[model samples]
Target chain A: MNNTDIKRITPKNITDKEFFYGHKACAGCGGSIAVRLALKVLGERTFAVLPAGCMSAVGFIFPQMAFVNNAIISTFPGSASMASGVSVGARALGLKDYKTVVFAGDGGTADIGLQALSGAIDRNEDIIYVCYDNEAYMNTGIQKSGLTPFGTKTTTTPAGKNIHGAQSFKKNMFEIMAAHEIAYAATASIGYPQDYIDKINRAKHTKGTSFIHVYASCPTGWGIPTETTVQIAKEAVDSGLFYLAEYQNRKFKLNKNPKSFFSAKDYLLKQARFKHLTDDDINIIEQQRDEKWEYMREHWK
Target chain B: MSNKKLFISGDEAVAIGTKLSRPNVISAYPITPQTVTVERLSEMVESGELKAEYMHVESEHSAMSAAMGVSAVGARAFTATSSQGLLYMAEGLHYASGGRYPIVMMNANRSLALPWSIYGDQRDSLSLLDSGWIQVYVEDAQEALDMIIQAYKIAENKDVLTPFMINLDGFVLTHTYELVEIPEQEKVDEFLPPFQTPNKMSFEEPKNLAFSTTPADNLEYKYQQNRAMFNSINVINDVDKEFGDKFERYYGGMVQEYRCDDAEVVMLTLGSITGTVRMIVDKLRDEGKKVGLLKIRYMRPFPEKEIIKLAKNVKAIGVVEKDISFGYEGTVFTNVNSALSKIDNAPLSLNFLCGMGGRDVSKSDIYNMFISLFNAVKGEKQKRVQFINMGVETDE
Candidate 1:
């Protein structure tokens, strides 16, 4: 859907009052949209803890938060821990009633904040830890992150005559978190609003730690058009590049069927981040997606 | 039952103490001194000796994090690490304390960063003093065991919902096996109550957790954490006294003074190094040096009143430390200076950085250090800090 039809599907039930609106986000930031949808699904019972990332900087201003309930703490790489503390403290005081949530970017989740995140999960800190994966550290002027997919050009991983974008592939954080044997962990995208909301609802009911990694598109960082944010995000999952799955009781289940898939080129061509790729490069990307798809299907099934 | 006894190392005793408390989960990563505690726990889980989920994480950071997760779910949890492993999980430590997950951890005190060595030093635990944890330093294997059990009681107390770290010196306590009275699980159950978190994720009571802290709520939450820590001071004494009365092991108060009555000189120490000071004090007493040793038990809420009270009658005080503060002085020395500042005409607080990077702090080192401190007091030429008999390397 284009900009004209956006209002129709934007969830009529959601109030126009942005829980964290009127803020500074690069005109079509996926983090902003995802946060909007997340708060929409979770409702006012939710409390948000964000670290030093784009959302922490722009999403919610002081005294006036985008969320309705409560907004507390800002410690880079410690959002999950802080959330865990609030939840645990509430529980200790017989106030076991509110949702405690942590919102972090890929840099905070996959890199620096990995330890604290791991600890919260290990402790089964009964909180929702959301990682809005926009590939790079967009708030820090587009530096590379462990979540940055290979061949995605950034300031650090410059696209040039000899140099490739990123040396390593995007670290599969969803699978890594699942390895901790947490009760609930799944992948979602701003592209599929219904599916994303359904997953958050599912996590709300699940006991122990719940992790949701949202594939958020960055119009400024990825050099994509402001309007096609959802379209690009959907194509990433539809192309089987980013699989949607859940892990519980040491078992994996694919939340979204990958049978009807599109070519990686459909997802790649639309974004400016992959504009430098040639036909041969697209083939390599398609090949990697297929291998990963087969590997996940093998283990998941 | 009154004289229950068993052969145990400091780490093993701590493991036994943890098992007695019946932690629902135990996550652990290996490190020297701290390794044995978790290793024994691993064996317990493997052999069905303990009925709990033992998460063997890839790293210390994950281990502590997992323990926090377990505790968040309204389950009692425990984890242990030492030195580099403790430093690696430093961020997680603050999370546990701040999150108010009463996770009990043990640190086998070892040296800090730079040219890494796995020897006894207080730097690892001391560095984490400001991380909002109820930190208690144990001097012997028995105290280590008793304190581990007490840590849970104090930390999980309704009035003080904070995590705690029981610090014990490596080698001196961890390596040297001793006779520790193994208490019955039934008795432990009666002494330590079950955990009940207020807002847990349950089918009957669903709730959101670890939510974001707004700027206004942030200050109040921090203030609450600090207030909880200060309140824990009284709770520590109560728990320790109650347990000591039941088990005949006295370790409730923060600092324990040894022969400070009418003493002219006072030497301060912590963890297993106190053994050396005990011998030094005995030797100095025979030689009429009027010297005594003040062992710091609870290092975090810092025993401010007790420290000032202990040093009130003394002429000069020397703080022998196993860790350096870097760019300034020793951590214990800094704490002593601050604590003593409150007293009227307090003793001279002399700082000494010694036995770093796992180097042994022998009786000779303590004796000589105390002698120099005594001489400094008599000659009225007191060097604020002494490097002690640390291995020296001078180059042209």
Candidate 2:
């Protein structure tokens, strides 16, 4: 659905209710922003699941829980299965209306949780799985994750002369989910709050498993200024380093395809994790971005 | 439907019992011996005989995780697994128990893999005894079915909101056919009303559940979990008694004593091996031997009290189990010793490490075990732990 045709809920129209707040999230935490906005769109009647990751760590500190909706912390690798259970449990219990949402991190989703998430999608579980990707295992002090971009340094994937940074590219999570032929799958960035909210709204209304991978920047882990988390995340999308896309009904749709991209070199230089990269490394990263966008431009609608 | 006798395998009995429990969610992956239970449940779901969400999860880890989800929403959940699959869900096992999710699982007792054998053994469940689950072993297909029904009532009790696992010997009980009197659905409904608990995420309260706690507050949660699991011993007795009153079958709470009245040498057994041990005991009794049998039903809220009471009268107790603690003794032997140690004058206990990796505990083997025990009572000096039916020479 296009913007004009769809009756969208903006900040002005969004509920004045605050469901997620007063947590230990970093000042410029994009993951927290994503969770707050998604919870707003899904509302208080939602059964939210936070796996053993960043959001769960910050939100569920025993007596000081931040979620206003009924929520539970799932095992690190069991977000999908647990979310599926919550949805079916409520349905089987004859609860007519409710949403089941999962807020997982990069490692929790792309690495450990992939199998369970795929299972849920295969079963066509009526739940929304929002993966707030911070590129690394931010909760555990910035260890490299499956979604960590190449040339980025983390505790696990350290930068040095022998190996500059992570030796692998970010996994194509959005497409991997699309390959399941899920009811809906989307890639979003915290930089673009409106787009992220729109995708969550689609997930809220979906009758089957819906996946939304929101690129949330980790200020503490990435060594970026707290206030620049959203800007940096948005710039990566604008620079074609990360693209916004959706998969529905066996079709891939590109949400944002800049005719003239922002500089990937500049985007990388802003983050401390990528500061160690040389000009040659930047060239390789930019080349990878160009190749990915070329294919997305040629293939996706 | 009225209660009717039907000859079926232990796995089929489990499926029937699960159906009667009326769980809202069942998530499991296919594993040997345990596969039949899920297959039958699937058929039931497809045929509209059971109305439940049968989630075909990709792994046992997810299977248990989903069951926790089912429980966290205050819905009844069921799952089945065997051997490696049980180990795969080990982390979730502790999580389910600690979360106070009253999920019921039927585990086919199979050996853990190294050389890899999909046969009857108590090692798998024994290995995970400390995972905070209330574990029970059945002697036959009938008890397997009956326990599957009672497991729900005991687990869902407000004072005992912990996960329960009903174990059946792989290939032996899981595959063996027996004439089982399936409880009528209406009667089972009366026995197990509905799973109700305060330990769930609710819309009315909007509570966050299963969160991390500071070390200051952590032990109290565990202390409470400990209380619930131990308190379940009474619930087990109460539930089994009520089941007997309604269904005409009673599993003697945590431990069942057969002919242990004034006996000097009593043999303890678990799962399907108990029947063979009972037969051996009966044969010795026919020959004028003062021998008896003790069957361990629940292993977690262990039959410590009953064991201590029984040991007070017995001269010696022999434990026949299929598990080893490696360089120590049988796991059950260790647990039984711990209980008997609590008393001033504990009886002489021997551990018989028999039937590993699904090997049959033949009646001959069980008879030999009793002979060994009877000999032990007669001041025969042998090792504390002996491997029965050993084919190879041991240095000892």
Best-performing candidate as measured by TM-score? 2
| Candidate 2: regions farther than 4 A off | A1-6, B1-3
| Model 2 TM-score (2 dp) | 0.98
lDDT of 1 at B205: 42
Cα displacement (Å) at residue B394, model 1: 6.1
- Docking class for model 1 is incorrect
Model 2 steric clash pairs: B120-B358
lDDT of 1 by residue, A43-70 (tens): 6666677778998777455444444445
Task: Identify the leading candidate in terms of DockQ.
Answer: 2
Residue A216 of model 1: what lDDT?
95
Residues B322-389 of candidate 2: C-alpha lDDT, one tens digit per residue: 99998799999999999999998888898989889866668887787777777877899867889887
Candidate 2 lDDT (Cα, whole model)?
0.91
